[model samples]
Target: MADYQETLDLSSYAALGDSFTEGLNDPGPDGQFAGWADRLAGMLAARRPDSDFRYANLAVRGRLLDQIVAEQVPQVRRIAPDLVTLCAGGNDILRPGSDPDDIAARFEAAVVELREHVDTLLICTGFDTRGVPVFGMLRGKIATYNAHLRAIADRNGCRVADLWSLRAVHDRRAWSEDRLHLSPEGHQRVALLAARALGLAVDDPEAPWPYQPTPSPADLRRENIQWAREFLLPWVGRRLRGESSGDHIEAKRPDLLPL
Candidate 1:
């Protein structure tokens, strides 16, 4: 962690993005996703129990960068949170024939707009997909987007949590069965990373994961087949029909409330 002056006064936080930020596959007891944003909020609330820590998450599943800008950004701006974390454009980059530069440009515009409303804006790079199956093909696009994000963060005053460089997220167990969203454990790790990026003191922020043995050829084949049937085909169908997982879904936590 980089050394900086310690001033952890996270009284209000707002999270904006897509399913990744919505905590897909990391289902909470109420059937809503409690992703890294929630975990980080919980931690912050814990640290300052005496303070009225509030949080609002306006992320929804399968949202494109443009959708986030149009729908979520306005709500966050209205809230005028003390801190805001934005993680979008992953869905846009995943589309067929999508241009990373175009997506990045749109993403940068959102960041510029949001940062104007809040001083502490947090951005994140997409994760590496060295081991993911079909999704691995888009690693180049993800990398390009990540590079743009770094540049945007530098030019703007936003702090970045570089998920692309986090080796732990590459583990198979870190991802859900769909290979798109992170598992609960994966969300926990990401929350730790985000907290550390915000200069919050956390225990074992750099904790290591145990090595995972490579799956046998037969096991890999079986898993791939299952994934194709369970996730890939449905995802493709949605894209073809111009539908989204979040087509009619609403934000789980739209209002800012005590965490």
Candidate 2:
């Protein structure tokens, strides 16, 4: 349990990605400071009290995969970080103008460039956006990106974190007003993931996770049914009993009642 300053230097790490990685909906530092990377840094600073691990967050709002390649990758190279954590691809999915296949390809290229300088790489698979109309294809596109990323990580022997599964559990409360951004609690959960993936212990285990209503199978199922009832069914499928748009099933969900 060395102090964070003792365990690592300020220049030891770097964070790269888009808005989710940047904490857009979060209250602190506005969009620039609200992301998972900041939460993770706070946790590490506390846990590794001796380590002065420095993390440079290069994520931007509304950045596409290509934008990351042209911007973030070069910064990573200059920093030459020991550990790199990246969460991207959501904007690519939501950008009506961009092709999914191309988005996946650009993500892969960015990862390749990142692997060159960073010793340990952590890439997020993105979230499960089953209910959002704008992100209808997000799940599939993320899967495609993860599959390719898996191959790349396997070849290079880097680490990959499945953020899709982590966030797959549905909770309207987990999302911010934007529906695209994660709430405060969501960022905390993400911090926990980053700590675990990097082999770092949480600063305060007894302290509640920064996020709430932890992602679990039961939660995911509940979210799915609610999602279907509110958006999917209302949009295209046969309308379910008492179902309506902009309204999530919130009471006594038979499917998740046991949990």
Candidate 3:
């Protein structure tokens, strides 16, 4: 790894990706999503109170790598932000018959294009799912994608926040009941990791790890049943019908605004 400059004058920040970046499941008081990108923006704002720190999030749920490249990437190029974070491909990898190599190739192309326009680029690896129940089946695919992501970042001179290596995120509590998105605490930890990856001065980067309680067999069975009924079934139904959760949804914070 190369040494990144510890200081940044981030006047403008833009985030591009899917639900993970859109802050899905991390609802705000006003019923809007407030995910890790938003949290990181807030922290950056606090760091430079005197400067005008602008941020935009152009992430929608259920977006694939192709959609992100086609739709979100152009907007970020137009914004030409001081810092940009791109986290796509997760949704694509989860789908049936998806190839990790193809995903990585598309992702690297996007990174190559984005890095040419932005001074600072940040990309993240997908989280490990070894701890998740049925989702653990995708662990190998996720690892392949993560490996490619690191290589892409290195070639593009982009920084990486290695979510796959973050042990805390493996904790079941770090995830929401849907098992797709992260909880508020999970987002917070990710935000801190992003800040640190950008070489920003962040407090409590080594925060205490979340405690994991062993669930009884009955509890596990009940939880699995609930997850299948509430989340998995709907997800499968949507896939069968070729529908998407983000079909009509627009970006939450589309325009750049002071933080």
Model number with the top lDDT: 3
| Per-residue accuracy of model 3 over 156-181 as CA lDDT, tens digit each | 89999999888778777678989889
Q: Rate the local accuracy (lDDT) of all candidates.
A: 0.87, 0.62, 0.89
lDDT of 3: 0.89
Q: Decide which is better by TM-score, 1 or 2.
A: 1
Runs in model 3 deviating more than 4 A are 1-5, 204-206, 209-213
Alpha-carbon RMSD of each model: 1.7, 11.8, 2.4
Mind giving the per-residue lDDT tens digits that candidate 2 earns over 63-181?
66776677777877766767777777665665445565676667777777777787778877666667665465566776766676667667766667667667433566667655567
TM-score each candidate: 0.95, 0.68, 0.95
TM-score of model number 2: 0.68
**Candidate 2 stretches greater than 4 Å from native:** 1-11, 29-32, 167-169, 203-259
Between prediction 2 and prediction 3, the one with superior lDDT is: 3
Candidate 3, residue 106: lDDT: 94
The residue-by-residue lDDT of candidate 1 on 68-110, one tens digit each, is 9999998876888999999999999888999999999998898
Model 1: per-residue Cα lDDT at residue 83:
91
Reference-based TM-score, model 3: 0.95
